[model samples]
Target: MTDTAEAKRSGPNSPQTAFTWRHAGLAAEFATATDGTLRLVRLDRPGSTQRGGAVDARSHDTVAPETALPLVELTALGHGSGWSGPRFTGTAFGTRLAYRGHDSGSRAGWEWLTVELHDPATGLTAFVELTSPTGLPVLRSRVRLRNQGAEPLTVQSVSSLLLGGLPSPDTLHVHRARNDWLAECRWYTEPLRDTVADIHVDAHQHDSRAALALTGRGSWPTDGHLPMGALTERDGGGRTWLWQIESPAGWRWDLGERAHGTYLALNGPTDAEHQWRFHLAPGGELTTVPVALALGSGLDDAMGALTSYRRAVRRPHPDHTALPVVFNDYMNTLMGDPTTEKLLPLIDAAADAGAEYFCIDSGWYDDDTEGWWDSVGAWLPSPRRFPDGGLRAVLDRIRERGMVPGLWLEPEVVGVRSPIASALPPEAFFQRDGVRLTEQGRHQLDLRHPAARAHLDKTVDRIVGDWGVGYLKLDYNIVVDPGTCAPGDLAPGAGLLGHAHAYLDWLFGVLDRHPGLVIENCASGGMRMDGATLAVSQLQSTSDQQDPLLFPPIAAAAPTAVPPEQGAVWAYPQPGYDDDLITFTLGGALLGRVHLSGHLNRMSKHQLGLVRDAVSTYKTIRADLARAVPFWPLGLPGWTDAWLALGMRVPGGASYVSVWRRGGESELSMPVQHLAGGEVRTEILHPSAPDAGTAIWDGDGGGLRVALPRTPGALLIRLTQGAENDHR
Candidate 1:
């Protein structure tokens, strides 16, 4: 009975079995062995903090605490797993280290019945290791996922790295760049209560807050902020990721479990569509996602040591956090099922108005899209609606109009009436009683099967190669799909999500082949705007907040707006609505993607001018603003409201700040601290206001406060060095 046992399933009365553990070289790293587990303490550098914060216009008090990572907590980390089915009972080598994991349990999915060994790092790296796939230490971890569930199962799962100890006044919040859909922050605030209340993920500032009974409730990915300070060790700076592996349905989750008030999480592929459904023969082995953990640091000086920790071995330094935003001009809804002929004028006008992309939407291909679920997988334009030359002619027209052509595809899904459904090998679909069930406006297509993958790949080649599509809008809305979890490899309980992840994997693979080709993921709006989708596309439409006229202000005001750091970080103001009001409201959303959502032709001349000017102004600050950080005066009284100041600090150069006002007052002064520091001067250039000037103020010591006029609550201030004052 050594710490490293070679035990196996004893058949209730047989010999004990143990998993194998292998260790490699290490200089000063500590390796502690417990009853059946090992801990690799990676000593590293202290955490780093976000340097800047938004300044004030009315009063420039001390800045709010920027992001910080305290070091003392770095020693905290763990690894273990709850047994949904059978887990390894013996010691096993994973991520180059040796550990143990238990197997078999009730409520099998969330069961922690058996034991689990771990080589948990200080929240710096997830213990994503199975037995080595290569040989010993240089690279690899090979392990297996055993499914014990009845019926065919597919396993698609997502795990988050949880960290605590955060910046006050603001718990960690991450919003979709567009909608008010908030995602669960890895950190739980209410000390763990389980109540499902709706918190806006990509919400307007006024709508982002939600009261969740933190303990028992797992908020939907679109209702809460990203939990900040969830690192296992001290926090300052470090990187983490969510990872997953899919089977056709049954699977197990591994994690470290000790109740000393620590942290854990799953990063990287946030919503990889990996649910629990895998169609596994009882006691059968399924494709495993055993050890797909994160790598990062909290120990400042130990960076070099941690960097060479081996687990991060040949992994690429990928940018997983933020994605770019896109603006699409073509409206896609059926709009009461208008005919293409009736829509041509509107579509043509949108293209002429400088729309970044012009899509034919749903009606372009046929007269009836209400039954669109039937039209999918057809891959051809209907003759009834598309008269003489459809897609080809449209492509030519779009290119001539100077805009990229984007086409929509739902490869992971198929319509019951789609011609290809009957053509597809029966294995390509999710079957129940010889019939495939459709859910949420679509039917699921399993992605784990090679045949399925091959089919999808071919479709992309044909569509992109033949149609000359610039962008691919991958709309995923399947709710009952038994997604691909490797051929015959299903997770334990993945219902529709299992197929979802496999489907995403398939699409991402296709995207990889098309260089410079951007993807627009729409899980019926913002449902699929997970990290996986974010990694593949420039931007994702946060929601179906498509009505330009009514949704502009609401779009601009949702609370779960943007990640504090990236784009779509604020609310997006839809077009039309109230041009001036929308102008002022769009202040906070300089980061992430912001696109128009209504008919441009309907706008009055003034509205059109307003939009053109707004877009122009956005271009002017495109480098600094567009998708950068802007500010809103929170905690202010209503009506007697104030203007929002958009400022950019130019490194070693002049900084520009734009103020958009909506509330009364012909004028108001804003503090200019977000701009370049040092001895600087301010100049006001209000294009519409007659009163303006280059005012010389003490810009040092105090923040840069500018006086802005009414109507637009607009003010543009440029900060430049007053001279060569070396003292900052």
Candidate 2:
């Protein structure tokens, strides 16, 4: 069969299939309805028979125009009539768009399919582009709009992707994650029927106007909710659709019952939600943010596919392959109060514990005796903190001990009291009504300005080039809501979107200048965790929760949104903690990037030995993490669960599991169904203490029974199937 197949129309008013394309085991069909609207009629496995024919027949008999949604839903001012029902759906211009043509081809490592549509009334053209990695059951989509008419157009909302013809609402379950400052990546599942109430569509002959919508506001894309969701069949059919929107600015998604089945719409920013508007001149064009959709038999399978897609799209860097252990002086240790006297011993201790990079986080640039919170624009080291030879002396010591040196930097914000705030022109800062906007005593920088970009470039060159720093922790601590608007922009959200694009370009330029340096993305920790930011940065700080007892859930759920190798989980073992407590904290980071912290120099010999052992074990298995996919044996974790298990399925049918016991019974059972009916061997990789914990493998039942004698204990276990050599 050919790669692309085109079907001709049979009659003027008769329903006809327009196109059918197949790739990576999935088939997509586009059909023209009786009213001449091009709709995405079906998306399913290649060999599977259609499941909702009878329902679709009934839907056509009742409401022919609402059977399926168009390829793209666009809302523009003064171009189309007003829409009824929900705010973003059923736009007159979108429904009346005429399909021009479609083409398919391969470029680089991706296979792409583009469908073109034209708005005859306004002379607007939209190219809906869909691409996927070769042989991956994942599709990413975005829309490019060009204004070819005489009059200018102001677009209010445009969907990146619209998927229709899903399973019946009564048979589906929706999953979403809620994120906060201390609590992050907490997922919950609900029935789709509950969200979109049944309004007797057959009796009323029209679909419901309400929708189950989720929106993220402000510059922090993932501040309130993650830009991801999934819909799985409640019955035993085992079909799931998991999706993510790739944007670092405002984003919104909605799903509701249509005439034939449920439909999903994913978008970057809309006027109703984020006050965003885009003005297109006669020759101007705009491209929407990209969104990805993966199909699988279950949630885990879909997540694994998404993991592969993420790796395929990310910027190539050595940090992903090396998986080096980094030690930062912040969490529960220096607490952002770093000095030469305080960092010397910690640097030596970190180097002895198998750490390859040491970072001096925050408070390093406090030349004033007063507080440093409102006066942190100058990226220079404090002379008062390092009296003798300056901060360079401490960095030299770190390098002398066979470790790379790093520093903490918040590049997008200038403190209100900073001299740079006044030195730079008003255009360099984010301003509204000719006044700079301040949040938490810090002014946001408009990276779209040349002066602002130049300032950051000079700072990065001096630190990474002249100072020889090899790593940077880029942190953003303020939230600039609605965002900043210039004179011609329609709204603040539009300017914010422009700045987001500029910021990403600036990041690429910095990496081009310093290719070897590693950058870690942080926003008070995990606030800005999205695909766009993660694709450019090497690592992501998962959270800032200082309490070890409350961190296991965050660490366990990090991989669902972030790849294991890129999610930096902190393991801070303090001096006052016992051996079991130390193991508990260290175990949380074994499967992911080990962000080691705490004052190891203050610990005794045995405590230090435990830290060293964890680092060594991580080094042995870190190579496997680059190719591994994560799984949860006991399901997505609860915030206060007694026991939590996170596993990584590596190549050669081997897996590594990290189990944490916070409270309740010491004995717990977790099901690893994939390894069932196979002979398996389990070994404790860390602590090596014979009495720390015991794990019994049940090959027949595909379960692992763990017994930890203490209330707060943890274990890192490696499970290998039937005669496979242990990679570690």
Candidate 3:
């Protein structure tokens, strides 16, 4: 099951293949140059050969020193900067690393391969670890560096993964997603040659100095872009490489032309981009953030593999499978102004609508009538807002109505005017140059400090343990740019990295204490949606747009960035809205987590019936969501697309598709290759009314034609194979 071999040099001056590992369908080969520098020359699925064919046997000898990057790229304070390029290449420390040894092992269902390298001059040892699930075409990589010398080493940049031997730029295309407040996961594809232009390398006898780089800075990892990307062959070879950087803070990935073909560098916070530096004393060690790469025949296949990898690595919890429905009084209902008088009736309405949990979002702790945005450190109930038995009374009503109580919390910040701002010591908050860092009237808490962590733990325990709350909507509304720094820290970015890790640790601690509690991750609505946070949090709020018509694209494209069961899409139906609008909003969330919100207490019985019907339908199909793999029949949704479609397929069972007609024609046809050549039985699962929409399955053509008579209508359709083709 485990295979490994070491390559020996044929001659003293010739380049040698240092090591080769083949496991789980992935083959990786490391080569050592004449100078004894180690480089990862090959990483590919040998069984599924591409049109460009395997890498040349003599590429290790022909590749230029600048392009033949080491297996682990390390840049230190006193190292040689780089070659004649803007890229992070040709570092002296990276070039000096020589292959030491390697090992392979298997545990449970996962296999791992570790390659060790050493730099004699600085006594820096690098261990490159690569892991993957058995029989999967996916690989996760991370690097750990140890300083064994007498002198201290300050690391400015270290790559978690460095890959070479990709196809030429002319035969490749790149895909990346742009994200923002209301617009999340807007993906665009471009030719790799356009981003990293070919400067006639053959004529110049050298590779181009330019690189196509994507960098995310600050605490919001996905503020401007998602930490995910893909590169596919342009010749219809179906060779695709999809990758995701696992970090809650700053990260960067770049693709550029190298001597043999192309090279990719994935790293966490770096000195040039995020002012991050790590100080490693003698015998000290540090590990870089992990990154994952999945190879497949196409984009969808690669994404499916990546999805499985994501599900495998995340913290296991019942919430992922149970997927309980949540109702919050914030989106378009109370709007951060919740009171017992306002919530009691809403709680009853939510329970009647089958919401498993009811969360009183925001402003619950504010005694002031003006606002609670600025003064929000201490998470306590407001006596003026709660009255009589206080917030506990509203919670009791929710419990009485058959729903668990929940609360909103922003545990990382203290308002400038709040009492906790002064109660906590200055060291407990982020500070630089002896001054506390403030953003939008709030001071960021440095979770690395014991006082700040203890305060958060106390607040969470009081809310979850004492208050009997089962859900917590954790929201972060402000951004702390550059990062945080202290007297002993190497840089602000380094301090931010430490705080990010510490924050995750605190989250794990909270979950450990309260195993049944569900936490919703919200950072200004999807700004902090990254692999690292999604792996910990139970659910993710897709957006805060508040407009039902504008939410279709966001919900449709959310699965591309998050798992379907965890992407919480809001369904807020106002009393004045029609049945079509209600169904349109609710149908968008059927394939994902249903986050119900609205003025349900003020609606008529007829309107309330529509809401109840949607919830009932969600429950029927919710069990299949945890095992489904998402697909887009009409391709990734465009922001202005008149027709948007999201499909979830559960192998050997049935497939569910949610289609929305925003402002286009009456009919839309999309390809469904999996159901081709088979008889499919289709039915409308939501709205419960036959006249909501119409669908025609073109089994012969492997497509589905849908018609929504209304302009802004949506429908959830289920497709099950006929008995004759059930096994197919």
Candidate 4:
């Protein structure tokens, strides 16, 4: 449905309805309706600073305008009235939006802009906040809605943001990713015309409007697809814009065409499609999930902007810079079955191999029973598995080897058979209609309740304080379906969203209390990986794919969604594997957080030595890892790509490259963006013993020729640009 009605413009000097907020190259202008509906007038590279001339809604004020958009559309449910229409009326734009006011500020190196709007009839106020680090070409947005009416209101849907007037709607392409357990981040780029029927060829000049939406439902936040999208002009300016909904719950974003141009709409928890609704009483307020938007020259540039934005918004943690090597006992070894004897040797071997943290993943609290999955909430150390002095004996061994000891915890759900299920008050758990909501033998906790928060707080404190544990692997393994219904005034979606906010607050509170503790965020691996969780957690487990051969693409593409320092990719090198296979597995992690695993204790001395060498190489390049931007030499990796490459450009003129050869040519030229027209020298940094391969810099082609004699091999190279005389 396209609306061709043009929006009325304000005066030349001061746009009564429009306001501009600028920060260096990026500028955002917002238009407000007399009824208080807010619209994104312009968001793009800053154009001219000239005054207005009928304010061409299409062109920015600047002479060399980037991309300019019209008012972003809104559609939602109204209390007494029904659904909101395409155009705004005094009280018709869904609950009748009204502009209140706006505020802006800057702190440290970040700038913040907030706009306030409300619906007087419904007494619902919406506050939109945009935050960005100074000079960064991206911004993060979040919305807060408050109900001030005398009666309760049912908010069916609300937008995190809506941007319109995008350039070249006809030639636009949408890019996003499809995610599953093992095959995560499988990205696809398709033309908007192809996805929407409106753009199909009819030889007519009619503006056929079409819409395409990407959404994620339920608790496995990223189960079906990533809450992210991108739009690029295929034949026009070629400028690309990307966005991510930083929500761990239901989220939706729509790309559509209207009379003005293309538009992008971002929202969290809707009633029409996602079964999400909220009941807001007088004086009550609910905050929407955050959404991040980035604009750059291309996909890589936009991704780079998002990367920097992720780093800026995340909670400051020492672990980000420390970049420690972690040894987990789950993949290729242990596999959830752990014992004192099995772990002691592994801990000793991990320490000797230079692992900084040793995590006893899963099965730790399980008794020797076949029904461990359903009987899991107590979190107590199993007497049978740790017959000799309990689990602490092994923890002591990990500390004795100078490594931090960590434990795996799936804290969100409690098993029905577990004693904790009945121990806690009924009000602490999620209840629908009158029954407690249970899924797969596990019950979800409503974090908004005091008792639920207390239970989790006690668990974390007991483990961190009494046990002297310094690291935690927090995992969430279940989906809560649509949501939990609040007992009285709230709907199921609102109740679930409330719990989500409280859960993060609890996580952050845990961090505030245990300042030195490091938390690794995992949800069956990479499923719950979003900025909201990653902002508070120290590291993110990229995936749980056990096949060494299939992990290269996942590890390589992790940086697209997370920072390299926080992307914990598993590097499990087993004894049965050949030297080439070991290098392939270990190489996958060298560019990101090196999460070391596998049966190192069972490996031969020679096999263990290779692991040690890889660890040493990681440590040398880790300092640069903290302040590096990722670049793909062979483009984004395919799930089964023959060759994959990831480059990290550091502060200095040097770049670190990690390349994997699964089943490709012996020699392939990989391009390096930064070293385009300069004389550069490249050196292999890993597999120092047996000749793994070599890299030769080609300044003319602006790339490096990498040659590996054997297939299934890998190489890590450091590239530095300098003249022959300037070289050491």
RMSD (Å) of each candidate, 1 decimal:
13.1, 3.1, 3.2, 5.2
Write candidate 3's Cα lDDT for 1-728 as tens digits: 23433322222234554555667567766668666777766666756555211243234233433345787877888885668666766678877887777678777777788777889998999988889877777889999999988899999999998877677888889999999998888988999999788789899998888898998989888999999888888878788888999989999999998874877888888998999999999999999999999887788777877877888888999999998999999998999899888998899889888999999999899996657777889988999999889999899999999898999999999988889999999999999888999999899999999999999999999999999999999999888878888767889999998999999999999999999999999998999899888999999988888889889999998988888999999999999898899888888899999999999999999999999999999999999999888888998888999999999998678999999998878987898877888888778787676677788787767888888888688888889876332111
lDDT for each residue of candidate 4 in 215-327, tens digit (9 for 90 to 100): 78777778888888888768645477888998877888887654435667787777755677776678978777888888876777778888888998899999999999999
lDDT of each: 0.37, 0.85, 0.85, 0.77
Runs with alpha carbons beyond 4 Å of true place in candidate 3: 1-15, 51-68, 723-728
**Span of ten consecutive residues with least summed lDDT in model 4:** 1-10
lDDT score, candidate 3, position 403: 91
Over the stretch 1-728, how does candidate 1's per-residue lDDT look in tens digits? 11222323211122222221323211111122322223322311122132111111112222211111110111101222222222121111222222333333222111111223323321111232322212111111223344333443232322222211122212222111222333211122222112212343335332212222111111123322221121222233332212222211222222221111112222212122223333335465533332222222311112112212221222121111222223343443334243446445545655544455554444344545466656577566666665657657666766776767766666677777676777778777665545555555445666666776787888888778777887776665544432333344333134334554566566567656775666665655554434333434544555554432233233233222222222232222344356445454343343324454345556576655555554445445545432232233221112223444444444445565555555456444555544325566555432322342223345453455444444544445556767532111
Model 2 steric clash total = 0
The better-scoring model by lDDT among 1 and 4 is: 4
